[model samples]
Target: MVLEGVYKVRSIDEVVELLEKYRENAKIIAGGTDIVIALRNEKITPKVLIDISSIDELKSIKDEGEFIKIGAGVTFTKIVESSLFQKNLWGLYKACRLVGSPQIRNKGTIGGNIANGSSAADSIPPLICLGSTITLASKNGKRKVLLEEYYKDKANYGMKEDELLVSIDFKKPTENRVLSFAKLGLRKALAISRISIATFLELDKKGQVTTIRVASGSLGKYPMRELEVEEFLCGKKLNERTIDEAIKVVQQSMDERLKGRSTLPYKRVAVESMLRESIGDGIKFLDGVRA
Candidate 1:
């Protein structure tokens, strides 16, 4: 695909100005891992391209008081290397580490992954489990939307034509909380996720689950929390029995949602092991933390 013009933006204001002027005709490029492929396949034909990879304002990961803010331009490799994520957000770190290959991870921006709006996108399930929100800015103003709500339609995310996603923010998980991720792909290296799960679990002093959030990707139109499974896990001990029941709940939910789909049989069976591994990892991590 050919673009009419490519503008390297220096700041968010410049990006907004170009977006406002070009509207639907302009597309923002950061890392270009996703956009470049779309452009080559003629899936996206934009008259102008605004490159934001050089904007320093959108590249830093900062630790705010109650939450951590990840700049939209931050790459997956940066996420993997960040001590903050490595030390606390293991689920997100693991998901980032598993995204594509080294070169792809080095160049793929988290914002681009979210904006691409693929249900199979690796980072989204973990983000949803974390209760993340994204900030979209325009010449008009900025608006924040929950990550789960960003996808208003099957093929379209709710971002306005003039808006540029600037950052993703989520509250920091406390010591009692543990997050874990598991994915099934065709092959180990550079694999596109077929089915994946991310789980956020918190345990009380008695080793019973106090809070739980379970999210899956490549299983629906968009990544979503398995609320029924979450409800079943609450107040339950993270033992083999609870794990089995949780897996059953998730399988039942998937069966209801994907009854007639060809992939249902495989997915329903695969999801059980995925959830089991993710929940088991969370339990192990919590045990290690307490020890």
Candidate 2:
């Protein structure tokens, strides 16, 4: 792998100091799930490895006032076992639970998932639905990048070479807001997501959509907000008629985005079940709570 030194950092300041010294020559390693693969494959050759697993601050999940702050070094297995991810944030829990297999989940960090920049990253779709932001730190200071925008031009807009992604945070969905996720994989075990959908929704007392976010994975170059479908569903009551209409809008968006790709027809058809599962389950959960 052509690595010279592996500095096990105890704090963010130490990590930043190392990054400042090594700059682009250094690569941060946590969980080591994705980076190790890259190192072995010779896809990335870094002279220095800054390991952040020893930093306790980067492994905690904090409930800060109205937001949930998850440390970058936190593993997917940790999220699956956390009580904070229940109820309104269950979609995130589901996403983490379905990541790779139990062994991968134990070693895979959400930060690594985002840093990996895979188009089919499962955790990203639900994070996008939650409108999350990632914190990147350097010697100078910290910068916050919206999760949705980071994926847009990952080569350039993603974490800079001199920065370390520290944590991801988003507003805590209220009791009235429900988040749900549905994924289609080739098989039940060790299946990579072929198509996945996440929906975060809140309906008013009148049973009309007030806030809704839809996001998809493997449906585009990166997991992203389904803005057209969200726009179509806003203010509309959740029912068969509106859902059917929304599915049509999703298909049209895919048609425009894919532009005759061979996967277009398959994706168009597959997306419907994903939408129904996430959106319909979210509504039913809220409905059951009321009942």
Candidate 2 per-residue C-alpha lDDT over 1-291 given as tens digits, one digit per residue, 9 for 90 to 100:
468989988999999999999987899998898888889999889999999988999899999989999999999999999999988899999999998899999988998888887878889999999999999998889989899999886776687878889999999988999989999988999888999999999998888999999999988888889999999999999999999999999999888888968998989999999999999889988887666
Q: Which stretches of candidate 1 lie over 4 Å from their true place?
A: 152-157
Q: Would you list the C-alpha lDDT of every candidate in the order shown?
A: 0.90, 0.91
Error of 1 at 133 (Å): 1.2
lDDT of 1 by residue, 1-291 (tens): 358899998999999999999998999999998899889999989999999999999999999979999999999999999998864489999999999899999999999989888888999999999999999999999988989878645235488889999999999999779789999987988888899999998888789998999999988877888999999989988888889888888889988888899999999899989999998889889888877
Could you estimate the TM-score for every candidate? 0.96, 0.95
lDDT of 2: 0.91
